[model samples]
Target chain A: MKFNLKKMLTTFILFFCSIAFLLPFVWMLSTSMKIEADVFKFPIEWIPSRWNFVSNYQEVWFGDHPFYLYYWNSIKVAVITTLLSVVVSALAAYGFSKVKFRASAWLFLIVLATYMVPPQASLVPQFILYRYIGLFDSHLGLILLGSFSVLGTFMLRQFFMGIHNDFIDAAKIDGAGHWRIFWKISLPIVKPAVATYAILRFIWTWNDYQNPLIFLRTDALYTIQLAMQKFTTINGSFYTLIMAAAVSAILPLLIVFILGQKHVIDGIALGGVKG
Target chain B: MPSNPSIETKTNIRKKQKNASKRRETIAGFLFVTPMLIGVSVIVLFPIVATFILAFADWKFVQSIDNLKWVGFQNFQGLWEDEKFIKSVINNAVFMLTVPTTMIISLVLAILIDKYTYFKSYFKVAFFMPYISSVVAIAVVWQVLFHPSQGPINQVLMSFGIENPPTWISDPNFALLSVMIIHIWISIGFNLIVYIAGLQSIPKELYEAADMDGANAWHKFSNITFPVISPTSFFLLITGIIATFKVFDLIAVLTQGGPLNSTTMLVWHLYDMAFLNLEIGYASAIAVVLFLIVFTITILQWISQKKWVNY
Candidate 1:
């Protein structure tokens, strides 16, 4: 095949743009591993001259603040939220799509309408309600608030709707109940969609800053994002340690994205097209 | 007589069983969504109604419930006269300029990457990395990078013989711009993935047909590719507007609406009003205004889609 000049030029341009996009992350890792003295070196090192990985990470993880505690809190909240959200959304999606109940269409519309309501609109009132209900500064509050995602239900319902009615009819004839059919037959078929939603929900919860920032006050119950802010505020001059903390905060989700790149990308595309 | 009686009894039993099963199914359906309904009521629906009501009240954090003053339209009137609220609205509009910049860059990257069969996923992942990471973490990295004295960005600028580079994230003139730059960078990856999918979905036959008609690259792109991907573009545009309008995390982390409050967008302003100043009623007014803006834009987008979007 003949090489096309225009194609080559565009490829080179994209290659450079990709580097520019990835440069901050590269710099993040480089800074995270650098000693304080080497961090401000004029040459802007891509690789640290002196590897301070162990000490930097140690300080971030085991320093004056409870970084490890925050990490665990974040993990607990994210995991619980993801699981509850997936299950609730899946059930709701199944009910909306498969069950021939009265008022189902209206109920589904209500769910869809709620998707358009920005969380910030309800934030202050929610804060008051949480405080009144004794859920203030608690991980449970965050989990409960995040557990029911209208977007997840809407997306999954689309997938659930695509499953042929014949499957449900056959299950009904076989003396199967709605729950059995949902758990045993239809859900299995839509496993990929469910998994995609689950991964997206997990990442979203893990990266969430606003909810934890506003809801949780106590430092011990702080999520990693909240703790990072506290750490930065207290040790603002310790650039090396802050970068190390930043890396620790983001590394898990980055690993998740790497492992499930297809799901994350496809889920985003699905959301875009469907919307 | 005996055969008829037995048949009637059998039919009655079958009917009763069927009715019982129908009841069970209905109960199961309700049970399935019970948790979500409770969550929506307590967390989403009730709070929304309360926010609407609270917007008109004169409730302060220090005041008791019985001491609350019901001042209809007063909070909203206050918001109208508030300079900070006006500044935030303008800042939000200025910040929205990132949407188009992000879209153009994402579209160009998508097209370029779509042309190449090699390392496509690599480029896509690289662009998407920032989006997947935490905003606080990303913002911190940017803060370090944009440091006025020691940050590599200013260092590079000085090396290129551009003297006296502005203090990004610290200077009022450049802080909002700095935040916008980061926003654009973070959003490009997600938009690129979406656009690539849209580009891929455009039928190959259209391009082949255009080639047969002796259409040039620009002609084919304008007549075929652009129209076909209009829906995706429209989706991105609407969501981007809504998301950027409510931008809080980046500002909260990086600038905290500092350097003369130049970067204070709608949500950040609301946050400061409610959480910092303990002005719940006033903040609710801001929230209501924000909701109205987002809701209106969304409805407008839906109504206008038929005019431009192909599908």
Candidate 2:
């Protein structure tokens, strides 16, 4: 219970560091909601003196070039990709963790080895393949590309191992099939992990700029990030508006993290070394 | 780690499950990973193989498809002569050195937070706040902060009587480092949390034993702490190197490899080559090089883990 000066110094340094880390975000949020005049004043304001939330959010959401479609497109892609990734990765994790087959080890190694392949190496051929198949610029193409996550599969596999295998055996003796063992028993044990991965996957896909930016042609088909970039224009006149757009895009992610961060931290703390 | 007693008790049932179950399970395993296998094959694996094939050919990507200039060894042979790809590789090497320095700093900070009990969770959450938020947002905020005119960063410098700070993201000199700074800030939260876990996993008895030997804090750290946590350091280094190699988002936003391509690394160059110039064949060659570099390094790290990593 003693208050040591060393602990006090550590706490103080951390507080300053946190302030330093959090201030830019605080500045961006304030700037996005401020009047253009207030944005560039000599003395930077951390908070908008007058609240301009309604207009800022409005311009970002329903301006001359509305972000509504972009919002829907991003959300749609993220949701579908998350669902597909979760289902596939959970199954893959289960197979790697629970299913006993002669080929299981090899299959698991292939999956693990696949993670080592960098995605940029795939860009050119995937583009050509998509173009040939006429999946280019299509939402389905984006979803298809985004749906597979080897990292997610590997991460979930680690979690499934942490689960007690007795449940799997108990279910097998009840005449449960492989599917039933996965669905009824294994699924419940790894729900926290699944949820953890889903959050990470959702953030990853939502923030993804490259794939959609390349494949998507129409401004209306844009994700929020791309749409915001277009909204700001390449020339950068609408920089303040760009900040507003950035703020709106980041808002949802911040919410997701604040809500789910405990799980992610716990999962990472427990999960990283083993992997 | 669990055994089914029924597999021992009921031989006939076990044999039936084994025979029929073998086919059923194989099919099920394939079915389970079908989406990932298909998705990964189309988007990742197959494309990679195709890139290697395209390296030896000359497809204009969007142009004439029929006539492929069979340039055997020319593309790769051309790589050594090319300046930009070479520069891109060099920039990547510089980046590789700088990025890990940032992550190491974070690891130290995380250990400090962990060693002190009070408000550890609060510090952990605060440190990680930037990571969960959008990278684009962070870049934009950073652009403003690095603004030569009124940014708090240069502003503080100016107040200290430092004149004419280099224009970050605008000057070719500091652009790559500027981008790395933002990357460090974003990735610190992640690396810090990982190390805190590493610190916790170390046995308290080691420190207790060291204390009985009248070891100072520094001695205890070097003796018991660093070795125990070296595995986490190893993981961070490998992941850091890989992530640095594939880094694209921030560069595409902040500098666009501008200030005259000083910040352009392998993946960014690949993006420019493929999407910008439509030189798919050449870009494929470049991507093929990156894949080889990254894949080789990852394997080497995995092999070397035995020397340092404990658990």
Candidate 3:
């Protein structure tokens, strides 16, 4: 088959643009592997002449900066946040979608409306509240803060609504209660949606800089994002080390994105279409 | 005929069971939502209300609730008189310029990729990489790239015979602009995906009919594609504006709103006042102002969407 000229031209243009877009990431990897002097080489080394990958990554990982501690903290916070938020949101979504109770509609509206209030608006009060409750500067505090999301509830509810009521009605006839039906029937159907929201939540919490920045004071409790900020400030002159740290920081999410590209893309699409 | 007493008793028992089950359902519903309700109250709702109240009262981080002085709009008045606050607001407005630029670029990219079946997924993932990455990582990478003396960007500019290039992130003249560029880069991925979704939803028959009417590419796009995608555009427009207005992580990581506070947007200003300065009341006022700006714009968009955003 003959190639269409317009299609070829579009492909060529898109290819070039994609390279331009991915160049920063490429540069990041390159700089991360280069020795100190070669980092600022004028010709822009796409590949370093001397690979310092082992030493650079080692310095970041095993160096005095406590990168491993921050990594563990981030992982712990993200995992707990994702799991709890997903369960809480899924339950709330099910309640709103399937269960009939007094003031349910009004309650759901309140939750949805709160999603519109930017988190920054509530920052000061939350800071004070956390301080008063003795939860300040704690991982549990960060996890709790990230656990409940109205957006998650709203998104999952849309998925739950798509489920036909016949399954629910049939389950009800079999003497299954709301909780049983929610767990045995409805939850299975909306598992993909739940997973989508979970991944998004994990990524959000892992990458979150604001909450940790405001809430955590001690270096020991710092999340990776906060740690990166501190690391950059303290070792600003070491470009290779900073880039190595940056790579280490983003590697997990990048792996997730690569492995679950379809899910991430679908999640984004779901968000757009639903909104 | 006389009614059977046993049957009547059985019917009454069944009615009681039904009521009991109904009560169980209500209890279960409440049980499922209770945790989330508690969370919303403690984390979101209470704080929002508290922030509003705090905005009217003069308080400090060091003070207790008992020492809270009721200043009633004094914080707002102070914010109005503050030069830094005014400059930050203007910076936020200027930062909003990224929304349109991002939309146009992403829409074009989406259109180009949408036409080709091959490499579509590849392009999608490539573009979206930056969006999923941590803001700190992206900021640091860009900071290196924006390095005045030895960065690739300046090096490229100098190779083209430009002796002097503006120092990004450090130069007051170009710090906001530099941040805008980074913002646009990181945002294009999300916008591209959304636009692609929007473009894919447009019915093919419209395009077929337009082709039959001898419509050219521009004509077809302007008449058919543009109007059809207006809802998606409107959605992205509102969301993009809100997201950009809340841009603190990037500022904090990259420029720290530095080089004479040229990059100090609303949320950063709020952070500085509340977290850095410990002026709780003033920060609350800034938060309220930011919320009002977002709320008003969203409401306005909702009201005006009917005029041009075709269903």
Candidate 4:
């Protein structure tokens, strides 16, 4: 454990670099709280000149647009999607891991293959289908679109397969059904994986811009990402206000990651791609 | 022999336990999985097959299913002659070099952070924070940061006696580069995490052995570190490249294929044709071309894995 000066110097610089990486976000947060006059203050104030920060949020919440509509839409879509995706993935993962069937592998491959198709590739067809089904511009429709993902199913299957057979066999011997075994024995053990998948799906669905952009025509149905996209105009730009909106949109994701970090870290650690 | 009392009691109990639970498992499994299965079939699965077939058909609104006419290779011909489409393909090639270079450097940064013991998660969180945020939000912020005049970046440069920083978003020469910078910045977290994970997988014993052999940090890295992470790097390379090729949202939010269509990547081109111009047949063709390009490159990388992606 000799003290290597080169290593120390590099690490020292990297620490500040990492901080510098965070500087834009810091600046955004500070600027949002600053008075409109101090928005471009020289010497770069890292904190606000003003103590109170309400008018901006006040406008967002109660403006003619009422961004809370966007907020509510985002929450509804994200929650429904996360729950649907997780349950479906968990069930499918358990099936693939435990069930016997002639065409299971083929079916699973088809599922994974769906991930390879770029969403852009399916844009027209999905639009046609949603339009036909009368699900267009509806919240339930948006939820269903975001919820189904093959990647989640594929990722969860690996975790379920890692669960040992002894517990499953014991459950069976005790007359526990597949549902009970899946719920009690399998689900609890693979909770880390389930939690990780949930966080990812939630973040992705929340941050999704493309789907909402295309499917959501009505102003009432806009997600936060879509709202933030339409914030900028060619003339009379509101850079500070948009930055404020941006920060608000990202805050929830930060919260989710903070709460789920341990489970996520364990999940990544289990994958062991680094080794 | 025992068909009376003993057989009757045993038969009843066995039927209840076996059939009851097994029957419940079959029905419950299907019920639990139905939502995803139905969603995937309609939204995801059927779309793939439908889009491919629709690629050959000539339709404007694509509303009347009966009005679709089979126009084999006609749409592809139009896209080939499209000057805008041609420019998009060329732009994609230029973008390819810029994003990957940034990915490599950030990976090095991630590895450095991994080696240092202090502030690991803090650094991880810092590097990864940008990733979880909204792409549209980040793009909008960067749009201001790279503003032509009255922007901090140029202002700081002028303070250092440098002058005339290009208008990043508006300048044709810098527009694609500006997008590339954002792409790289946004991507660093995921790539860093992947690289850091790859780095951690390398055993300490190899470094210990290298130490006994009088090997320095560079020596150990070239031999021990590089080979071990090749698989993860390979994974990132294919996935990142594919992701870059298919990039859309940020470009849509930031430039909209600015000043003179200099920033018109293929996805934007395809999107414009269909939605803006209402040319479904031609747009479908462009999408198919994009798919071919991505699929071919992915397969090439997959093939090269035997040689370069050592695992």
Best by DockQ: 3
When sorted by lDDT, best at the front, the candidate numbers are: 3, 1, 2, 4
lDDT of 3 by residue, B157-248 (tens): 99999999998888999999999999999999999999999898999999999999999999999999998888999989999999988898
Per-residue lDDT of model 1, residues B20-73, tens digit only: 777776788788777777777778888888899999888877778887888999
lDDT, candidate 2, A38-156, per-residue tens = 76665667777866777777877787877777889989999998998899889888877877666778767876777888888888888888889998888888888877788888888
> Model 3 lDDT vs. the true structure?
0.91
| 1 versus 3: better lDDT goes to | 3
Give the lDDT of residue B190 in candidate 2.
83
- Evaluated at residue B162, the lDDT of candidate 1 is 86
- After superposing candidate 4, which stretches have Cα over 4 Å from the reference? A1-9, A50-52, A265-275, B1-35, B62-67
Model 1 Cα lDDT, one tens digit per residue, A1-275: 45576666667777787788788888988988989898889988888889999999998899798588998999999999999999999999999889877677887777778777899999999998888889999999989888989988988999999999999999999999888999999999999999899999999999999999889988789999998988999987888899999989999999999999999999898888767
Compute the lDDT of residue A172 as modeled in candidate 2.
Answer: 75
Misplaced by over 4 Å in model 3 are A1-5, B1-18
User: Candidate 4: TM of chain A?
Assistant: 0.91
Q: DockQ, in order, for the candidates? A: 0.71, 0.64, 0.77, 0.47
DockQ, cand. 1: 0.71
Return whichever of 3 and 4 wins on TM-score: 3
- Report model 3's chain A TM-score: 0.97
Question: What C-alpha lDDT do the candidate models reach, one value each?
Answer: 0.89, 0.81, 0.91, 0.78
